[model samples]
Target: MSKSDFGLFGLGVMGKSLSRNLAQKGFKISLFNRHVDEVEVDVAKNFKAEYQELKNALAFDNVEEFVASLASPRKIMLMVNAGKTIDIVIDNLLPYLSENDIIIDGGNSNYKKTKERFDYLQTKGIQFIGTGVSGGEEGALKGPSIMPSGTKEAYNNVSQFLETIAARDKNNLPCCTYIGPEGSGQFIKMVHNGIEYVEMQLLAEVATILKHKGKNPNEIAETLDSFKDDANSYLLEITADIFRKKEGDSWLVNLILDKAGNKGTGNWATITSAELGVPNTLIASALFSRYISFYKEHRVQFHKEYIKKSVSRLNLADDDLLKAYQFVRIINHYQGFKLIQEASEKFNWNLNLSEIARIWTNGCIIRSSLMEELVSIFKETNTILIHSKISKMIIDCKPSIKRVVSDCVLSDVTTPALSEALQFFNGITTQHSSANIIQAQRDYFGAHKYQRIDDASGKFYHTNWV
Candidate 1:
């Protein structure tokens, strides 16, 4: 019996799958968990057989003992909970781990926290890697998009193993990459989850309306069926199946609560966006919606407050809803790009937006057929996407889309989730606004200075109107 090459420090759903994957991929696996019961001898036997003739591998009680069991210059992955638990494990494990022993934090960790941990580990002369693993429980078992960030040496240490186990893009490049020096990988994944929030909310709101309008779940499922033919993502494609299927007797989604639950990544995105002074109102609103859902009393109060005022009642035809749905989807896409732009500026990450869309085509939540087309739109056009082919689709559907928006306003049909996104998209793409000019005029008149856009120093321009 001897130490193994790869080790998983947590054996929750994700950790277990990753361990099995590494073992199946022919790596000797050293697995450990806080709970001894989670580590089974039968599973150990399965692993030994899966990768026949492997070196001796065993599970341990805690991080201290686990790190002690590993060979010199060790490689152990911590797939435990993201925030507080990560710190606890790293603190305990740091004492036993020597230099060049790469420790991979493969969880949905916040990028800010990732950066902080990187700096802390550096003080101890240890290599710390933070990777963003997407594709839920199943993906973790088979393969997942592994967005890793840390030092160059750290990436090289485990890149080959990561590439072998990671999910692939259309070009088949392992979904794993050295995103940037540190924190960039988690930051990008944060945006990915934010986009996911908006997408699901948009679909849920649409479902709410359709169900209320007396459309059977099957009929709605039938509508989703065509989405897979040309342009589709995993979420939409699978949602269609969920609606199309009949369990004991109800739509699976209907069985679940209308309220959504997020794992803090989306909230992290929204919070970071505000910190960067970036406008991510749509995603912010979607995140807010989840919080609002929790306040059952407030929702009841809101209904009573506006019940007499006639709020959020849509009497639109089916065509209008479809057009609005398509337009809102485009808006969400554009907003996602805008957030990426702001993030790039803030982090100096130099992210390729189109490549992001491509990678997301299958492995991530925002994957869609339309993303392939949008990728080309980004390649050809250097300006705002409002003038691109995606925007042109909006243009063709403008009449009905506008009718829907107008209906939302007049009838007080609160299209808050979708409308806010559309408006946010429109506000950014527009060139002139009398309101902006007036506000700037007032600022210059009162303060006698306006911030200069192209100045080497912190200079202000003074313009006096007679």
Candidate 2:
């Protein structure tokens, strides 16, 4: 074989699954792990096509040997941690890599870090790609979608193989594609995670409310399962099954900690959004949700002292609650999309927001059937939400949205992330001015620091009545 279309540099959960997946696709696969025996017996038993797959091309004790073993323009996908580990992997592999070799960082890497790595490697004619892969271990093992961004040359060398391995989106586009130049793939992935946070939080709030109102989680799941077409997302589809599960009086998710932990991608999303002057309150909300989750000890104190004020009657019937919950999730989705749309514009991402939806449709964590609608909208409009059919539908459904948001606020049912995110989205969309004036007043009187574009900087200015 030509020592092409086959190489991976990690044997962890994702790497192991992906390597086997590649072999399953009839690729001339060459597997490598730092640990020699890590993939030996496993591949022998599971990957039947690899009796000699690694015999001539097997594990390498070091990068020096692995690169020498491969043909020119070697393609190596790295499935490792970010930060220092990436540096270490790069340093070790650089000696063996010739010019034009491709190194992909497939972990949940910060786009800035990927950009830095890409820039550094490019000077040596080495190509570094920041590829975002989703579908988890199973996705990796069978066919996961891949978001790759780097030099077009690098993509040219790899597209055939990538297409062969990726899951297909609608219109038969490869689940894998070049997102954009430089860090866009990773940047997009970061935003994807951030949105995921909001969606999860909104769903969590619904589950909490359902349980509090004496409805079984299974019943909640059953109701969600009934939704079809664009209304159903992969997460909701899975959650439906989860809700139907019963262990005594609670679901398994109920037993899990409410606080979410992150490896800093969402943090990166929030930071980048700030730097680009893009508002990413949904992503920011996700990060805050994680922070709030960390207050386990503080929660105990709060439950004793603060929860007394969480009183309200939400005696809506299960059917009505289900209707409201689905509508809220739609609001949540649109709001997240609105944040994405606004951020892309403000950051000059010039990004195809609808195409972004298409990319995430099958491979990433946020993939859902609703993206089909979004993708169709993008095909017809240059302007993003203002004139899309979906936007029209959302307008028509504004009554439900308003009712749900108002009900949540009036009853104090504690949908802080979803409700506030919706309010933020709605305010921006309809040009809500009261809050902006209020904020200006607070800043003008309190810190006295925000700048007005129409006025000069450095010196402060304010008015009580003007």
Candidate 3:
């Protein structure tokens, strides 16, 4: 058999899809899965048979044979679970791999772990690329937004395949790019997932507010559809579709359970934010909202016990709701980009914020028309707050967001994400805040010291008062 251009391990959904995508791109790929049992072997065989028409595709039941089938300076991609599974696969492949061979982890592994693996692999003279492949199952099969970070040489070696398999932008440019070195790609993907969580939560809040205002799912769907061109996001498009979905005689969305499930990435984002002291309040609130929903039983009992009178519904204009939604969406992107900016500084990643926006312009869940504006803004200036156009938009939309949030509160509707967005906006824009009192209190209790308005920079003072 001819040497395979790439090797893909883990015959799971993502792995299989990516393998097929690569093969369709005319690259010879060797597919392998850990064959601990007959069932596993059968899966690999079935996968190969399913894509047998792709003359460039091959499957191997043995790990050694899989590695051997690859061409020199072999490129192997692991699409298995994050954490220990990635390490286990790397260990298994280490014996068969030679110097300069590249191992790419296409999982949602922690950036810290990716960095550790990069260092460990470097000692063995092997290259490691911690890549972020977004767009889910269908995106993996067709094309994904790829973020790769490793040595420049390793990136150069696989750039052709990665670019070819990535989704294209409006100008027909690939959505794949070299993010930075040492787990930068995974870090960016984590932030991407974080932003996604907040965006979804905000959309759900909008839906809830619409429902409270006596709009049926169909009505809400229609209302949301109007924003599709303005927001122009995949999430919004899918949300509009979700509102229109019917199961039997009822809307499927309403029939669904209230509990939201998480896959750890949201929590990771919050944790990283806290660790970095970046104030990712919007994303954190969204994460907490999920936790709140998990207490469905308690909520039900509490509402029955304490809630007797119903609040009067406030009539809100569809235009107001749309404006508020757009405001929150912008804040969501701001918070995510702010987190990324902080991470890049702390990690010395020197990440290109504009390129990050460009890559997310398509294929990813958060892909939005707003990203085009962001790409331009970041390219012109990294100072997000100082951008005159964006700052003006925020100022102009603040009133609408405030009105919507206040009405939601009066209606007894929870809009944690929206509320946090307003708070975030206030926090960043406020020139004078009550933090001075906080510092005074800390000084009174613990002698932590406080800086006076007239004091020289970096000078701290403490006073005793009885």
Q: Each model's TM-score, in the order given?
A: 0.85, 0.84, 0.97
lDDT of 3 by residue, 1-466 (tens): 7898998999889998898899888888888887766456556667888765455577777989889999998999999999899998899899999999999999998999999999999999999999998999999988899999999999999999999999998888999999999999999999999999998998898888888888899999998899886676898889999999999999999888999999888999999999999888988899999999999999999999987878667688877888888888888888899889999999899999999999998878788888878988999887676789878877878898999989888778789988888988888889999999999999999999988899679799989956
lDDT of 3 at 375: 89
Q: Rate the local accuracy (lDDT) of all candidates.
A: 0.74, 0.70, 0.89
Q: What is the lDDT of residue 134 in candidate 2?
A: 83
lDDT (Cα, tens digit) per residue for candidate 1, span 187-252? 888888888888887776666666645678888776666545744677777777777777687667
**Residue-wise lDDT of candidate 2 within 407-447, one digit each (tens)?**
76676666666466557656677754666576587776775
Q: Which ten residues in a row have the lowest lDDT in candidate 3?
A: 36-45
Q: Assess the local accuracy of residue 363 in candidate 3 as a C-alpha lDDT between 0 and 100.
A: 77
- Pairs with backbone N, CA or C atoms under 3 Å apart (clashes), candidate 1: 232-369, 312-412, 312-413, 312-414
- Model 2: which residue pairs collide? 218-244, 259-293
Backbone steric clashes in candidate 2, count: 2
RMSD of 1: 4.1
lDDT of 2 at 110: 82
Q: Please give the lDDT score for candidate 1.
A: 0.74
